[model samples]
Target: MMTKTKLPNKKLAIPKKKIAPKFRDAFIRFYRYMIFFGGRGGSKSTHIAILLLSRMMTDEYMYLVYCRKWSAHIKDSQFKIFQDCVKMMGWQDEFKFNQSDYSFVCLRNGNRAVAKGLDDNQKTKSIAEPTHIWVEEADQMTFDDFDTLNKALRSLKTQNSFILSFNTFINELHWIRTTIFDKEQQYELSEQFRNMDTYLNHSTYLDNPFINQEEYLQTLLMDNGGNESKIASDRYGLWGQMPNENPWLYAFDKEKHVRVIPFIPSYPIYLSFDFNKNPMTVKMFQMSPQKGLYDSFVHMIDEMEGTVVLREFCERIKAKYPFSPFFVTGDSSGQKKGEVGYESKHDSAYSMIKKHLGLSDKQMNPNGYNLTYENSRILMNQMFYNYPNLYIHPQCKVTINECEIATVDEKSMNVHELKKDRGTYAMDHFDNMRYFFQKYFQEFARSNYHATK
Candidate 1:
């Protein structure tokens, strides 16, 4: 009856020395907006988890919201990280985890941490005022999504903070880059953001004390199979190169290929189309066929999207280039009967294009077929490298953006095909360009055919 009863260890000890030096200060202090972005093995997630757990354990009113792009991703990611941190700190008995909704509560205090996904708007909106919000894989969310989340941290009683942790795989044009990193560098902020305090810290695998012990990670980071972009992003925590690591048009150089190419009204306008409903795309080019293949110039003067109706799109093109004669080429799927939304159910897309634009069958690419994806990739890359005269107008932003970001399927056994699952309009504009090139300059499809000759 007098036997001493053991009490659970309530002490929380975060291995401060074990934490990366660059991120140690983040655990002790608070910033309105804290950004921890870098390469793999940085311990960014570990630090954030520890910080949130510590805050929740100490403060009764502390409420932390952990978010990712998808709800399904939270269990394996942030939720796991928190569980590991709790176990490592020997605080397992002090907290209770709810598996159903991916939440946990500090038994010592009323503080709680819940996981939410940005994709589930209803769940995200249902969350009451949270003292802290952490967005893991922050780059997956657009600026609007981030802004909405940031605005939701409206608790006045506690010191509210927002944390963003992500890898450096995003390109220069990404919202995280343009808004946070770039503006931070330039010391520029709008009136709305001037009141907020922001802190940014970058850490790579080298910054991790235990990185050497993780032999697999070390090898993976060191030997990236000649993918310089991946090495730069995953090892060094540098901004990724535009167009991604395995860009479909690897040979494209924006400075060399994109320029102010004026419209040649005298030359027949070559129009290329891709008929995805949401963002039906078109690219307009004019060619000087009199010049030799290498010397001849094909200037893409304009690009348009979002006019889904074929008649409306044709009218816009006519209004823009009223006097120029036009030639047409597009996705062979346009040849199929009953391609929706672009035209009436009775007429095919090509027939509608011919009718609206008043084009003869001779002016259109008579071939009612599209080049294979592999073939298109090869020919487009070849054109970018060897066809020096091929240029996209500086104003053709959609085409330029596609050329810069469209990537090949690096994971597949056949790596030549373009990756198309990114979004509905992911590669629509790029496909239009490829279709036009393959049909209009069929000779370029031959691997042996030199553009210069």
Candidate 2:
């Protein structure tokens, strides 16, 4: 962490800007949990920075623990944002900045505002009973991480509020969405989290009074050519469906493909596997008896290895769909023998899925059509064309993200190749789906051909 300060030993006059009516209520209310979620240029960060600085200046007891997902980001982004705010509010002369501690101290009251990375255990440990905490980029945090911070914040005596600000990603199954945005889940949340008045406020660039309208409109027009999600999220500040940049599975659409559909117990659950020792992925697909197309709804990506992963999948399946039959399919590589021969006779993944799930040869689609990469792409695209037939559930967030977010490599023309622009650990679930698609589509095409003949 690095810090710089400019103090002239005299208090400077603050400027008065026309505050928007929508923000007035938030400024006054003292909610236990305050969430400001929306698209870019929403002034969520700006308003909160103002509020924090105002409290520090007025109250002698005010203390804050401001955090970002990565500690390094604190210095470059939020730190600078606050530094600018301090200047904007004309409080530069009355505050003392400590670069070593990554904190700011009010010269008059001795009040302190600390900045840290949530992932930095050392910095988090230093945050002793902070009354207020603002987690910037809250979407990157996991549920467990949020729970830990929540518990820590509750133990404090002074501050009554904890704030989280983020832009909504396409993954509807994110913990933030499930716990905060979903109306049905609010009851469950209220029961678990007693005495906490949770408030969720959404805003966008359009709602922001300070935003440059002319510049924003020009940017929106540039993005309007094909990037609907960007226009929706950045310009309008809505939680848009997705942004498909150089998409590999180009046919996936939120309107046509994503929905809530019930699973049929009569239909056997088809499992597809992607065998990486670290992040082994398994996807579930079952044909809809009524709709006459496959419904891929479940996705499991585990860090465990070998039979343990298979056992975990089996346990989860049994718990979710107890009576439903389990069928297995996957990459041809799963058929190979493993070095861990001491545990069972069959060391391969397909054998483990069979043994653990109690699936016989009839239940397993071994080899999975053995389609070439080009043939697999063609088959998937063909299935995608029949939009009404194929569907994915909202709960399969990672799978949906992979299918929609995946892009083609410039050189190899391969979808799975990780790029600098697109981060890693994304294509595993999508690859698992490919194995199932190749096998099931071949059978589907064959059956239709026979019926026509």
Candidate 3:
């Protein structure tokens, strides 16, 4: 005969100070759906574990069904998290663990917590009267898997909740962004979902209180191998760019490089052009001095595109910035007469720009010859890493879109050639940007070259 140990009747006290402030409110409140997402080292999983354990201690009817994409992953992830939480809370004796099934039962109130894999639908469905469901790495689950688990929360008496936690690794077209969030490109809570008992919380490694004590985590987050998408999604917790197989501007991260840039009247404006009959494009830029890390910052203020002649495009620029001083640079081919349009057969594209913008030969800085595509790609990507102060104005949507989607031909002998199959003006704006860098910032662009011994 064995004597049963008496369970403590006192309520467990959760240390609020240990919890990141961004997650503390959600720990105490009840919402039908709670989403906690961000970059690594945010302590999101640890907070969820403590919240579930605390609720189990308090609510006598608590039944949690914790799940991931596969059942085999539960033992190492969610199960270990709960086990660590129990030890951290010093509640080891209050719970009975079933190691074989990855579950535990609270000895005090008969509450239970079980781990299931979304891969095993029947096992997840068999969890009767689940009061709460937690889907870790929710980005891995499809809509059907989410629906199945959502419908499993059938307890009529208990206030049911569904929790989702993940890094912002998915693209804009993903169901989580399109269906759940109102705006595809923003990080704010959706007003439509907020009214429907949904709670959203975002955090980054900077939010972790323990980050100061962990130097390795800080170094890893800081050094992302110059991957702009990783820097955006991992360091800043922003929506990642759509993955491209052979991106032309591989280091272009909209999160790091796009922002609201105001025009400075004191700085002379630079216009870079890419001339085409169907749709001519021009990018406007301004340079400002900086104190640290970088000597100067390049601000792409605006972009213009239209199916018009060189004269018409110049008129549009003059109308926009009537009094501002302008410098011109673009395609070396623009130097050839009779190529622009019927309106200016005698004047080359550069000459037409000079005539319309009232610029001198000193201001006209077109390269004598265009840099090879291979050289341009190498130099531009090098600048993106070495000079981190480059930025594009949010209003320059065309430029931003081109930077994100433009791809190169990896199979071609000259792999730097842009993939022309995307569309007629697929890489027009990208070319305009390249021309600006190669002509105006030639010194920085040539820094990557090494002389042969």
Instruction: Provide the lDDT at 412 for model 1.
Output: 72
Please give each candidate's TM-score.
Answer: 0.64, 0.63, 0.52
Pairs that clash in candidate 1 = 243-404
- Which sequence of candidate numbers ranks them by TM-score, best first? 1, 2, 3
Candidate 3 lDDT tens digits, 1-453: 112222222477777786778788776567788888887677889888988887888775788989898788889999998998889878898888899999999888899988889887677667788999999998877666777788887688677889999888775645577667778447766676667677788888878886673674567556777677877887777888546777888888888999997799888899999886646889999986442244578889999988877778889999999888898998888888876254457878888789878899899999888888877887677666566578999888778877877678766788778765323225778888989988866564564342001
Clashes of each: 1, 0, 0
> What lDDT score goes with residue 386 in model 1?
68
Cα RMSD of predicted structure 3: 14.8
lDDT of 2: 0.66
Query: Across residues 1-453, which tens digit of lDDT does each residue of candidate 1 receive?
Result: 112222122465567665668777776556788788888778899888887888787664888999998888999999999999888778888789998999999988878888889887777777789989999999887665687787789898777889999998775546566677544453243333444566677888777785573684668656777678877888888777533767778888998998887777678898999888756889998988753365688788898887457898889989999999988888888888776564467888888889999988887773477777777777777777766488889888767877888877776777777876433126778889988888866674464454322
Give candidate 1 regions above 4 Å deviation: 1-20, 27-30, 70-73, 117-131, 142-160, 183-195, 210-223, 242-284, 289-295, 301-388, 393-401, 408-425, 428-453
Q: What local distance difference test score does each model get? A: 0.77, 0.66, 0.78
- TM-score for model 1? 0.64
Q: Give the number of the best model, judged by TM-score.
A: 1
Over the stretch 344-421, how does candidate 2's per-residue lDDT look in tens digits? Answer: 655777777777788788998867345665556655665676524567777777777667666666667564443322
What are the clashing pairs of model 3?
none
| Candidate 2: Cα lDDT at 317 | 63
